[model samples]
Target: MAILSDITLYPIKSCAGIALREATLTRAGLMTEGIYDREWMVVDADGNYLTQREHPKLALVTPRIKANTLELRAPGMLRLEIPLGLPDPESAPARTVLLWDLSLKAYDCDDLTAAWFTSFLGLPCRLVRFHPEAQNLANMKWTGGVEAPTLFSDGYPVLVIGAESLRDLNERLHKAGRAPLPMNRFRPNLVVDGLGAYEEDYIDTFDFDGAVLKPVKPCPRCPMPSVDQATGTFGPDPLEILQSYRAKPEVDGGICFGMNNILLEGEGQRVHVGQQVGAELAF
Candidate 1:
């Protein structure tokens, strides 16, 4: 049986993810301690998003949620805590942050938080939370006009990949004399085991109990995967190897890995690791 082997929550976009045994399945994505996946983002002075693609050290910024705060930790930095309370929209400071083509309103965090990020990153940067009222939906072109909601995620609400798929890639890497890669390199929210290699690419929906997630778009890989999650540095790149066989014609020949998913049902359901997931294939 195909089972949910792991569930990861990325409290901040493009940063380290928190592995959870159980989490709430919301329409926007995974939720833990009232924190939604990709709820916070790191941005430059102009409000443009900063990701591991540009700042690989972001991979070392680990986040953990407490009773009423989000605590962040880095290699050489003291832990920083930010309150989890959502500010009143009318009174809180707001900024028009540029996330792809969408310029949505996001609340600017305090100067201390900004200083912490800037000091650690060695660049002027700030942390911003997604506005409570902003409708930051994924591109409808990929969702078939479903208007799936997301926060600071690159595109979709959730990303799913099969564990065997990674094993297959590792096998290839072993044959090529290159070191194997971990799942963190891909940063998927859900990792299912017991499926054939790349079988998630053909699935219609992943059903766990009553929760449903539809795989809508093929996830195109970028150079960010080359950044080692543990070391926060670029190592032997894997895109060169994927380019030989993982290109998807539907995405303009972009080398693809996981499947971009959208929540279709059970918005308030709880999803757990080790739960059996029924895969309804599109075929």
Candidate 2:
């Protein structure tokens, strides 16, 4: 039987993730404590979403939940809080922010929050929460002609990988005398155990009883994995190790770790640890 080995929710785009033993699975992604994954983002002076691609230090900005507020803490910076209350349209600071090709309105957070992020990332940026009016949808081509909503996520709602897949990679690394890697390096939203190596990439859909997810795209790896999940400091890149055999020729030689997935059914379901995952293979 397959069991959910891990659950991760990223509240802010391209920042750290929150690990959970139990979480609510919505059409968009994982939800815990009433907060949806990637529902918040940090934008530059021009209101463009900032990712760890340019500012690796963004990995250090950690978020913790507080009563009625989300507290953020970073190295060498003061603590900051973002009130969970809905913004008042009349008084809220509405600005256009770019997420890939889609431009949308995102309310600017308080100055303290902005300063904390800017100082931490060494960039002139402000924090922004997803506007209720904005529609951030994943590409329809991967959703089997259906539209699924998502927020600040790279492109999909979920990223699923199998533990045996990591074990396979680690086995190779061990033979090569390199240290074994952790699942955090891939930043998967869901990690399933008791599956064969690379089982996820071959899975057409992962149906957690009612919640269905179609793995539509091969998640292209980047330098972000080099950033240590615990220290938030970067080190040796994993691309070299993955380049040996992790390349997906189907994607024209793109290296991948996880599968980018879109929710197909069960919009507001709960996914918990030790839950069985019924997989539908693509081939």
Candidate 3:
């Protein structure tokens, strides 16, 4: 039986991920301690989100959950903590933030909080959280017309990959005399074990006992994967290996990694590690 082997939530996009033994699955993505994936983002003056692809230092901005605050720390930088509680709806600073063409209302974090990130990222930027009132949902056409709310994820609510998929890639990498890569390199929200390589790509619906997720899109590979999750340094790209076989001609020859998924049911449901999983193929 396939099982959920790992779950990771990125509180801040392109930064470190928080590994959770169990987390609440929401339409927006995995939620731990009530915080959704990519709930907070760092945006430049143009309101474009920043990522490790261009700013590797962004990975050093580690987040830690405290009793009442989200503590963030960077190398050689002072630690910053922002309150976990929601800001005053009427009094909080509001602004238009763009996450790849989707102009949405976002709460601009406090000046001090923004400065902390600006100093760490070495750029003029501000930290912003998903506006409590803004409605940002995933594209429904790709999701079979089911509208699902999202926080600040790139496009989809969830990304699922199987352990055997990584093993398959590593086996080739070993034969090619290249070092093996970690599963974190793929940055999947869900990692399923006990499945064959590339099994997620054909899975139309992924059922986990009580919850379900529908695979919506082929998660296109990006430079983000080339950046080492541990050191934040860029290195050998998996796309080179994937180009030989993982390229989806239907996707215009783009190499794919994980499968973008959308929540189908079981909101606020707990997804624990080791839970059995069943797959329903699309065709």
Tens digits of lDDT, candidate 1, 202-251: 99899989899999999999999999999999998888889999999999
Clashes of 2: 0
Write down the TM-score for model 2.
Answer: 0.95
lDDT of 3: 0.87
Candidate ranking (lDDT, best to worst): 1, 3, 2
What's the lDDT for all of these models? 0.93, 0.85, 0.87
lDDT of 2 by residue, 109-187 (tens): 8898888887887789998988888888877876777787888888888889999989998888888788888888788
lDDT of 3 by residue, 95-153 (tens): 99888888889988988987788777778899899987888887877877899888888
Q: What TM-score, over all chains together, does every model reach?
A: 0.98, 0.95, 0.96
At residue 188, give the lDDT of candidate 1: 95
For model 3, which pairs clash?
none
Q: In angstroms, how far off is 57's CA in candidate 2?
A: 1.6
Off by over 4 Å in 1: none
Off by over 4 Å in 3: none
